[model samples]
Target chain A: MSFVSLRNVTKAFGDNVVLRDVDLQVDEHNVVCLIGASGSGKSTLLRCLNLLEVVDRGEIEVDGQTITNGQVDVNALRRKIGIVFQAYNLFPHMTVIDNVTLAPTKVRRVSKADARDRAKDLLERIGLAEKADEFPDRLSGGQQQRVAIARALAMEPKLMLLDEITSALDPQLVAEVLTLVRELAETGMTMIIATHEMSFAREVANKVCFLDEGVISEEGPPEQIFSAPQQPRTREFLARVLAAGRL
Target chain B: MHEVLQKFFSPHAFRVSLPDVWTGFQLNLKLMVIAEVLVLVLALAIAVVRGLPGRGATPLRALAIVYTDVFRGTPLILVAFLVGFGLPGLNIKGLSTLSNFTYGVIALTLVYTAYVTEVYRAGIESVHPSQRMAARSLGLSYWQAMRYVVIPQAVRRVIPPLLNDFVGLQKDTALVTVIGVAESVQQAQQFSQNNFNFTSYVVAAVFFILLTIPLARFTDHLIRIRERRERAQLT
Candidate 1:
């Protein structure tokens, strides 16, 4: 069985359909990149997978267990899946170390000393050990985004969902955030990333899914999806992306 | 101007009444301390109940809304009268009788809590929704997220406004005098009536001004520091 699977998922907000009968699968350690224009359901899809947005109809199975049921413990389910947003929603009131350690100590019930040690280690790995004592507002956008990633990592989640994590950064800062994602992927962390950065998707994603207007129009190995897409919609989207010099 | 100043600040009148007003001033300080603590605790509780999400909390939210509305709409003097007199009038078992001082504290707490509840709710809402999202995504439950992440930040932003309300509350403690609580204003009234001079009233006003000016300045100091910190973040 696939490590993660969604069967005929559908979601809507009033009359606006954000995901319609979408089916997807991800094996263990697979890096899947979702590529689409704004309002094309990429972010919504990731949100649904994390149960941030409940599906109006469908079944989601993680590690062969059905997690879409209302009876599932959402907080426990969320602990196994970490999600990072575009806005880099670091707790502005907390120092970098506190932001990273809060979940471990509060939610996971780790001892304070152990959580601190693990938070420090994660910050060091992200090249931000010197910033542990500084508040998030004092950090640059790139640094804040990295701290957000470290904060997510402190949970030691099995699957990581990154929703346009670099879209809010300056062009120069985007590369630094993406580099950390690449390192995470290399270390065998399973991730589902929604992105506008096509080249980075091609380089890092094992599979690429192109979504158009609440549906996955085409999906394949990154090479096939980027170089030679099968579907007309995928081709047109890529053409526009290429015309914009983004490919 | 000299004649007017002499009437308001007559040295003989001020000196003669100082001890009487001082005795009442102590009562004012005590009432303020007790009432302020109760207001903080009760206002926060009301705000949190009103803010609770989901269908299960609808009744609680409605109750909180009605409470703030009714209490805040009524003139405080009337509320004080209602609690100080009405409760004793009701003559219910076990609650029919209490010290006038206790009744005075209850009255002030009820009225100020309504105002403070609104202040706290504004502060709680001012915290960006993204902060809650971040906390929940890390597996914290809704109440847990609010307790650790939202309230602390919200409380920080609301400190200056909360202090503003506190100053208002401190001054309002004089209102309890209508219930025969014998605070500074009541003492001033007695002196003015007995001595046929209004200078004692000035002494009472001076006491209030002395109490509030430092708090007002402290609020300004906090605001300046917050503004400076935000500006530092921008550059």
Candidate 2:
């Protein structure tokens, strides 16, 4: 069985359907990149897997546990699946170290000292060690996004979801965040990254899934999807991204 | 100029009334401090109840809504009279025996809590929904998320406005004089009635200004500092 599985997952917000009969599977330690246009349900799909949004239909299992069912402890399940957002929603009232340590100390019951140590290590890894005492508002957008990633990493999650994490960064800062994700991929972390950065997705994704509207129109190894996409919609989307010199 | 000013000001009468007003001012300060604490705690509780999510909290939400609307709409002085005299008049065994001062505190706390609840609710709502999402996505339970993440930020943002309400509450302590609690305004009025001079009222006004000016300036200082920090962050 795949480490993460979504079977016939459907979600709607009032009258607007966001995800329609979606089915996907990701093996352990694999990097799956979800590439699509804006409003194509990439972010919503990631939200559902983390239980941030409930599915109107179908089931989601992470590591053989059915996370979508109401019987599961949602909070405990969330601890196993970390998600980073496009806007870098760091707790502004907290210092960078506090933001990183909060979940570990509060949710996981890690000792304060131990959480601080782990947060420092994560900050150092993200090249934000010196910013430990600084509040989120003081940091640049790129730095804040990195700290957000570190905040997620502190949980030691089994599967990490990146929801267009670089979409909010400046063109110059995008490379730095993408490089960090590439390093995580190298370290064998299972990740499903929703991204608009075609080149970064191509470089890091083991399997690339092209989403059109609310469903995956085409999915394959990066080389196959990028060069020889079978679906016309996938080809059309890629042609526009390529024309924009993004791939 | 000095002679003309002295006729209206009556510095001698003002000085003579100082000790008397000081005692009464002390009572006002005491009420302000105690009621301030109670208002902060009670108002936050009410705001949280109104903000509670999902269908299970509907009745509680409705109760909180009614409470805030009723108390906020009623005049504070009327509330003072009702609690101070009316409750005791009902002759509920234990409640009837409580001092008028305690009733004054209760009345002020209830009235101020309603106003503060809306301030707190506005602050709590101003925090971007994404903050809740971020906190929850980290496995923090709903209450845990609110306590550790949301409330702290909300309280910080509302501090200036909260202080403004506190200043208003401090001044409104004089309103309890109508309930016969012998606060500064009442003592000043008694002195004026006896001596047939209004100078004691000036002393009471001075005491109130002295108490509230620092708080008002401090609130302004906090607002300035917050503005500067936000502006600096934008750059």
Candidate 3:
């Protein structure tokens, strides 16, 4: 069985339907990239997987556990999955080390000393060890995003969702955050990345899915999806990306 | 100008009335401190209740809204009179045993709690919803997010405004004068009647100003420090 599976998932905000009958499968240690235009339900899909948004209709199973069933403990379910958003929502009131260690010490009941040690390690991995004491607003955009990722990884989640994590970053700053993500992928971390960086997606993603409006129009290995897209929508998107020099 | 100064700020009259006015101002100090403590605790509770999610808290939210609205709209002096004379007039069991000073404290607490509850609610709401989402995503329960992450930040942000309300509360402590409580304003009125000099009222005014100036300045200092810190982060 796939490590994570979404079956006919549909989500809507009031009358504005953002996702429609989307089915997807992800295997262990596979980096799946979701590509689409803005408003193609990519963010919402990621949010639904993390149960941040309740689906109008569907079932999601991650690691053989049913996410849609009401019996599952939502908090416990979330502990296994970590999501980093575009805006790098670090708690501005907290120091970097404190932001990363908060969940471990409070929710996981790890000793404060142990959590701090683990948080330092994560920060070190992200090349932000010196910034552990700094507040989020004091950091550059890329640095803040890295810290946000480190904060999510502190939980040691089995799957990481990167929702356009570099979208808000400057062109120069994007590479630093992308480099960190690339390292995460190389280390065999299972990630579902929603991104606009086509080259990065092609280089890192084992599988790429092209979404249109609210549907996954085409999905295949990156080599096939990027080079020879089957769906007309996929081809048109790639053409637009090419014309804009993003592909 | 000389006559006005002599009537309002006469040195001899001020010195004569100082001891009596000082006694009355002590009551004002006591009322303010006690009322402040009560307002802090009670207003926070009400604000949290009002922010409670889901239909189960509908009645609670309604009650909180009504309480804040009614008390905030009513004049502080009227509330003081109602709490003081009306409670004893109720003639309930063991009601008359409570002193007028305690009644004054109760009245101030009720009105200020209403005002500060809105302040607290505003502070909590001002914290971006994304902060709450980030906390919850980390596996913290709703109340845990609020208790540890949200409330501390909210309280810090609201401190200047909170102190602003207390400054008003300190001045309003004189409202108990209407209920025949021996607060500074009442003592000043008595001194005016006895000596036919308004200098005692000046003494009382000076005492109020003395207490408020330090607090008002402290509040401004806090606001400046907070702004500087926040701007430093932005740059």
Whose DockQ is greatest here? 2
Q: What's the DockQ of model 2?
A: 0.87
Which ten-residue region of model 1 chain A has the weakest summed lDDT? A63-72
Q: What is the full ranking by DockQ, best candidate first?
A: 2, 1, 3
Candidate 2 lDDT, B66-121, residue by residue in tens: 99999999999999999999998998999987888999999999999999999999
Q: Higher DockQ: candidate 1 or 3?
A: 1
Pairs that collide in candidate 1 are: none
Cα TM-score of candidate 3: 0.96
Q: Model 3 over residues A94-118: C-alpha lDDT tens digits?
A: 9999999999998999999999999
Residue pairs with colliding backbones in model 3 are: none
**Interface alpha-carbon RMSD, every candidate:** 0.8, 0.7, 1.2
| Overall local distance difference test of candidate 1 | 0.92
Off-target runs (Cα >4 Å) in candidate 3 are B1-3, B91-96, B226-235
Candidate closer to the true structure by lDDT (higher is better), 1 or 2: 2
Every model's TM-score: 0.97, 0.97, 0.96
> What are the DockQ scores of the candidates, in order?
0.85, 0.87, 0.72
Candidate with better DockQ, 1 vs 2: 2
Model 1 agreement with the true structure over A1-247: per-residue lDDT tens digits: 7889989999999999998889999999999999988999999998888788899999999877798888788899889899999999999888999999999999999999999999999999999999999998889899999999999999999999999999999999999899999999999999999999999999999999999999988999999999899999899999999999988
